[model samples]
Target: MFYFDATYVLLIPAILLSFWAQAKISSAFNNYSEVRSINGYTGADAARKLLDANGLYDVPIEVIPGKLTDHYDPANRVLRLSEEVYYGSSVASIGVAAHETGHAFQHKQHYVPLEIRNSIVPAVNLSSNASWILFFIGMIFSIPFLARIGVVLFAAVVVFHLITLPVEFNASSRALKLLESRGILYGDEVKGARKVLSAAALTYVAAALMAISQLIRLIIISRDRD
Candidate 1:
């Protein structure tokens, strides 16, 4: 019965694209992770140098355990890097660290898009968790109103994904520029960082596309039940 649903068919392209994006990022990261930067700067060193250069001395860097789990927490004014990123001196490590540092820069500059994304995080979290439950209950009980409500809630997630595109792109752009301007990466070294960042950017694009496709699929499914 589930396999016969037209909505599932509509989502196939998105599923494929998501898989491709994930593979691209993983490959790019793996390849660059083996190539060390000329300056021998670890991810933690790169983050600190970038932050200090930008006059953000107070923002501290912390090591966390995970692969590619690096992030900047605006609330705590801290940058958290994974084990490899925090200790390794590879191009991939510095690139990922710089990207997170870019987020800290955005927070310091009061970037409008980042602020907007942060503002809706709580609502987005709630809606994302509730959307599936509401949709399944509505479908099982044949309640169009509840199903519509679920669709509307899910729309918030799509909106969040859309807003996230600019935020992510700007961060990568900042990372590349700063890495070069600050003389952290030289000549052909920057190319490897660019590849890693570019691959990461594609993942965001794929995510946005996937969210839009799913939203459209839900709309189609709701209309058919009517």
Candidate 2:
């Protein structure tokens, strides 16, 4: 009863907070994208400079299509960026490029968290899609036992997201330190980089919070049936 009451009471504020966080992060990203960099280097160029500086000269930086689709693939040893981020000569671009490169740097040095995340990839992929569907199906059938089992499976998705928070935060931290120590960006550029990374971090935080809420909601619904 206490759990249900707590979960129900918190749902409204949680949903509203999620919306607010998303909007804030999106706005910060947009603002950073509009601000120019000191070196006049494009996101792709900054990425190249960082990679080359670190002797990762062979890692290709490509401009892929879409928004915020940037990532580094250790399997192919490529850093992919969206058109806006890859070509734009803005603080946001540099921040994103540096962040993704941080991932590559991590992969190169065999970071344990990234390694753990990579290991869970296959299972996470399956569970991400299947868990919610199974949980909903069980609820529709009025089977609390089945729903509870579905929730157990769904918990893996939450765990993956929780683990991801640290990986992302660490990447951002590395990116900021690299930019600051190497003097890659000047003036308000460092602040802008911090803004971008901090905003991105919030998205991960929001996702984890959402997962927690979903998990709580499922538990409440199952208990009601008992």
State every prediction's TM-score relative to the real structure.
0.97, 0.89
**Which segments of candidate 2 are over 4 A away from where they belong?**
1-10
Candidate 2 positional error at 214, Å: 0.3
Show how many residue pairs clash in every candidate, following the order shown.
0, 0
Candidate 1: C-alpha lDDT: 0.91
What does candidate 1's lDDT look like per residue over 57-111, in tens digits?
A: 9999999988999999998999999999999899999999999999999999999
Q: Write the per-residue lDDT of candidate 2 for residues 49-104, one digit (tens) a residue.
A: 88887889899998899888999998899999999989999999889989998998
Question: Cα lDDT for residue 124, model 1?
Answer: 95
RMSD of every prediction: 1.2, 3.0
For lDDT, the strongest prediction is 1
Q: Clashes in model 1: which pairs? A: none
